[model samples]
Target: MSVIEKFSLKDSLAIVTGGAGLLGKQHVEALIEAGADVIIFDINENALEETKKYFLKKYNTDVLSLKVDITNEDEILKAKEKIFKHFSKFPNILINNAAIDPKFEKNSAVNKSRLENFDARQWNLEISVGLTGAMLCSKIFGAEMAKNKRGIILNIASDLGVIAPDQRLYKQDGLKDEEQNVKPVTYSVIKHGLIGLTKYIATYWADKGVRCNAFAPGGVFNNHSDEFVNKIAQLIPMKRMANLDEYKASVVFLCSDASSYMNGATLNMDGGRSVW
Candidate 1:
């Protein structure tokens, strides 16, 4: 195939976890634009319906959306069966994009965000969904890909995966050290663990013609306080948070054959935040 043709995902089927989410929807859009059949696996039934409807009308393509709780192995398997029923071949593109970033109201107790005060239950849930879920999807879906001897597994990591979160960026003036709502430690841990998982899967499936890589993105602008945006932007060399759709093309590149040689690596599109 020619260079431009290598980027085409025609005849490819991609299953994106958290497909109804902000960036998840963007990844689906990118993949569909590249001519790939896409399936969305997310736990939010309402959001899943909305995403399917939006894409159907927008692209005039019947993008499938299944309400899947990735944390549950049974749900993953069932979702897989449903996928198999809908398509002739097993899906070859797996995007491990399901992750939870803790959100709390400003009036809520800020001390809960502190590491010392963080609950184990929250940690377990976050890790299970973010890290464990990815592994399960890869193990089940990728097993079939290995049978075919061709696949791409892309993990959605974060810039914080490369560098620690600057707690100062989340600092509230009146709050004490323990009362500030810093970025939750689980976000960093989950993202960092994803990169490690990417490397592990890449080597494990090397001989099976399966490639794995991580897509690390910096913060995206989604309506935050002006003070917060400026605080984080100053630390990034780009001097601003990314637009919502900015990461779409990069995601397409990583998942397509264009990145055929990029295995066990992280394509960090962080606007120079990790470097700075």
Candidate 2:
């Protein structure tokens, strides 16, 4: 096939966890644009329907939206059954994009999310959804792909996964470093765990024609306070945050035959943030 043709996902099926969120929506749109049939799986019913409607109208193509709690094994299996019923096979691509990144704005009030004061329940929930959920999807949906001897599993990691969060970026006036609002530790742990999972699955399934990889994307802009945006931007070599749609091409390439030779790798699309 020609180089351009290798990027085509015509008639292939992709399951994107967290398909209703900001980044998830972009992944759904990119896969659809590549001519792949997309299945959006998320726990939010309303958002699922909204995403389905918007994409179906915008792309004018049929897509499946299922309200799935990725942390629930039973729910994931049922969703897998639905996919099998509709497509008569497992999804050719799995984008493990579901994770909780608690809004700093909401949690920063009076240092509500300081690491020493962080809630254990919240940490467990985030880890369950981000790390455990990805593993379940890989074991269940990925098993089908492994059996078929052809598929791709793309884990959505973060720049924070490769390096520690600069707590200074989150520093606010009058707050000590300990009490200052900071990125939750769970976010980093979950993302880093995903990279490890990607490498493990990539090798375990290599002979089965299934490829596994991770994409460590940088922060995407979504209307933060000017101070916050500027603070983070200064840390990045690009001197700017990524637009939500910027990662779409990377998604298409990693999920399509274009990345056929790639496996056991973590592609960092961090706009030079990690370098600094």
Candidate 3:
């Protein structure tokens, strides 16, 4: 049998947090393709329901979409109980895809002059969702995996976490034109922390058969402008951002038994952007 067939999830259950977002929905779609029953945990009830409708129609698989807050342990625990009651056990796979990328959502033009003005509140929101949410989900679901001696936790990190950013991107956040570095303070800080968390948990539970790892994807154009997307494309060695298939493939590997031996390693799925 091929890897897709042999590596099928079959009776396994996979829980993906932030399942309503751009990347989160991709994770859910990949899990369903691999034959795993999936449960989506996100705060957006409408988006979650929409995702459920999409999958139900396409794959004809039963997908559970739970409207829960990732930052709240009580909400997660309650969702866990429901999952257990329905599936009889905790999920064998956990994909931490929910994150907040701190960039201008509405503005497209680059203003090199106004580099020092930024919302501290925006930065905090990024950290809370990107870092805190990942930590919480791991603590909750990882414990269950340890007891069963089988589980895979995939943390979605970013390439920016590895390298410093150019001042232009953050020039509006307060950087002189001559400054060589301009990092998005909050997003970068949190992704760095997530890598540390993955290593810590991997070593702490190596004997329990739970493998924790990460995938740092570069420049995925979900809803960004063409100008912004093309600019990021130039930096990559492959000269382009990854397509949906590329992202889906990497995620599927981490979810399936093909990566059973992998732990605490962050795979750079940047289309060779980090090298340049």
Candidate 4:
């Protein structure tokens, strides 16, 4: 097959958890562009519907939106059944992209989301969705793929998973490091745990032809304050935060036959942030 043809996910079914979020939406669009039918599994019902409508209208492709709380095993199983019933086959790609990334821009208040003051309840919630949820989805959805003897499991990790979050990037003008709003401990821990899970699943299912890999992406440039954006850009060797679509091509490459030989790999698309 030609190089381009090898990357085509023609007639394949892709399931994307957190399919309505910042990067998740791009994942869905990229998968559809590659000719895969997509199922969007997310907990936010409103965002899920909006994303479903947007993609359906824009791409004019098949998209199944499910209101799934990935932390719940029963919900994952039911969604799995529905997917099998709808497609009449197991999903060829599973994108474990769901995670609780609290928006620092929205909550710029000092001491909020600070590591020292991070609530235990919030910690559990974050881990549940980001880490445990991925595990459940992989166990349920990945099993079907393993049985079929062909599948791709892409875990969405973060650059923070590779290196610690520079609290200075999140520093506000008046607050000290501990008092300032900071990236939660859960985010790094969950992302790191995902990489570990990716390796374990990759090796366990290597003989079954189910390739499991983690995509460690850097910060995407959303509409943050100029101060925050510029601070982050300086930290990256590329001198800019990632554009929302930057990781799409990488996703296509990893999920398709182009990366057939890649397994148990953590592909870092962090634009050199981790290098520093």
Instruction: Rank by TM-score, highest first.
Output: 1, 2, 4, 3
Which stretch of 10 consecutive residues in model 1 shows the poorest summed lDDT? 104-113
Off by more than 4 A, model 1:
105-110
Which predicted model would earn the best lDDT? 1
Q: Candidate 1, residue 115: CA error in Å?
A: 0.8
What is the TM-score of each predicted model, taking all chains together?
A: 0.97, 0.96, 0.87, 0.95
Q: lDDT per prediction?
A: 0.92, 0.90, 0.80, 0.90
Task: Check candidate 4 and list the clashing pairs.
Answer: none
How does candidate 1 fare on TM-score?
0.97
lDDT of 3 by residue, 78-97 (tens): 99999999998899999988
lDDT of 4 by residue, 138-253 (tens): 99988888898999999999998899998888776865555677788898899999999999999999888899999999989889889988899899999888999999999999
Candidate 1 local distance difference test against the native: 0.92
Question: Which stretches of candidate 3 lie above 4 Å from their native place?
Answer: 1-6, 101-120, 167-183
lDDT of 4: 0.90
